[model samples]
Target: MEDRSVRRQLSLLQTSFLLIYIYRNDSCRSTQFASTEGTTSARLPPVSKFGTVKVSGNSMLPAYRDGDSLFVSWVDGASALSAVGKSIIGKAVVIEREERPGIFLVKRVKNFQDGNYWVEGDGPGSTDSRTWGWVKPDEIIGVVLFRYKKAKPLVSE
Candidate 1:
């Protein structure tokens, strides 16, 4: 009876995890997301906005601290291509790692060469295009719009 109970609990836990995974992936790939404070863009509609992603490491240390959630939006290649020298250069973006499927990294755009982008993190600890070489546009998820950080005290006495 105890073994059966344990098995049931495990099944429920697995189901919960699966659901969460699906939801996260769906939100990441699609432009749609819940109407949340940090997720929505002030100037654009939610449908044409970026998804939120939480920082997990110190790669972007000074620019972005760990645990800070940022709004990342998919880039419109048409518009970017229309304007030369304005595709993704000098922008911070969230890119999908080609080496490891489903893994995403947030880095700044250094340059554009051929049809690929050179991305690097603000901090020296980052292992970005410097190590992986150029990243294809398809691998880039979107540009980071803004960061949502906890507000500091209004009057720190």
Candidate 2:
């Protein structure tokens, strides 16, 4: 069984029209997340909106600790992101190229060349685009809006 606490957001099922709109409009940035429903407290920020998400890995250290959830946004297109020159705001993307696959990577966008962008972790320990290579525009999932700090574990609990 999936642990409710450990498991994070669940995206909603997509309709053909929605997918069509995303492709046709070419503004397919936000991904509509399906809510679990019935659990108000568990309701996470809309996946489409630049909102907070829980971190489930340790690839990003120092800047992010294990189990430390954060907020990110799904921004697309190198041209649209040309103005962005700071750290990537919680842009966790999946690498699906022939070389990389099924990897959930989070970091900031440094430089954009051609159709790809350079991504890396803030900490030296982090292995980001430096290790993998250039990040294509389609690989980016979204930009992080914020992350709620994980609560310290109690000795008793």
Candidate 3:
């Protein structure tokens, strides 16, 4: 019957749309970043020295959003108090919550004074140094270098 034919066509269209959505939102896409440490090409540093982190909250909005992936370069907390860590000021960093052993947060380095780091988030509702006090040098995990934003769904409007 014609009704059955129309139903089949609609089902096929729906299936095609689903496939397109899945392809657009695929998370298994390549995550490799080429290394330029040894070459003089003046590109980004080696990907081997960086680690990826997925943002989970909106605390770092405007700069980073939830579900966004970040590439970070690891740091040595022991040397963070020295001049080596001074460069960390004004950069966004991943910090392991001092109060909560396993919790992590992304915040911008506000200041480095009195052997402590003052970090804050860009979002007004962010829970950063204002709520958690100063962040210790050893709490800093790494500095953010790049961000891979999640694909935004298309709106027909």
Candidate 4:
């Protein structure tokens, strides 16, 4: 999955509100940039909720490296709780870490059982459910639909 080609292709899907800034550390303060500011012309299907996630670590390496930008379809606490294992299982999600409160973590949903979601990072030695245990559905912020890594040069037709 080292190919940045897939990221370049998916980067075409976008929306105004989906623009976001990347951070290099857990600290929220950092230089900001808009993902949709002339990089893409694609449009997201008219949906009520959508947002972006910027990778600052290698936890999801291979599928999503550091600096990769992900366009997510946001699912609020209420909707996520009701959906349970139906919509989120087997999908990559941005979740509010219960331990860190406002901090968010991106991981793939591995399973749902006993009112909790088993999420894990794609890379070995990555910290996730293996260390924190299952996450509540309400903790899930969104599900990833498309990714755009800025480092990948877009291929013009």
TM-score of each: 0.60, 0.49, 0.62, 0.64
C-alpha RMSD values across all candidates: 15.3, 13.6, 13.8, 10.3
Per-residue C-alpha lDDT of model 3 across residues 126-150, encoded as one tens digit per residue: 7778877888888876788888543
Cα lDDT of model 1 by residue, 23-64, tens digit: 665654542322111233122322434466677677776888
For 54-155, candidate 4 gives per-residue lDDT tens digits of: 666777777887677786777775565565565667778877765665456778899878878888988787788898898887777678888864543445
Best of the two (3, 4) by TM-score: 4
Worst 10 residues of 4 by lDDT: 32-41
User: Could you tell me the TM-score of candidate 2?
Assistant: 0.49
Candidate 4 lDDT at 24 equals: 20
Ranking by lDDT: 3, 1, 4, 2
As a whole number from 0 to 100, the lDDT of residue 10 in candidate 1 is 75
Cα-based lDDT at residue 97, candidate 2: 34
- What's model 2's overall lDDT? 0.48
The reply for model 3, stretches above 4 Å from the true place, is: 1-48, 149-157
What root-mean-square deviation over C-alphas does model 2 reach? 13.6
Model 1 pairs in collision: 50-73
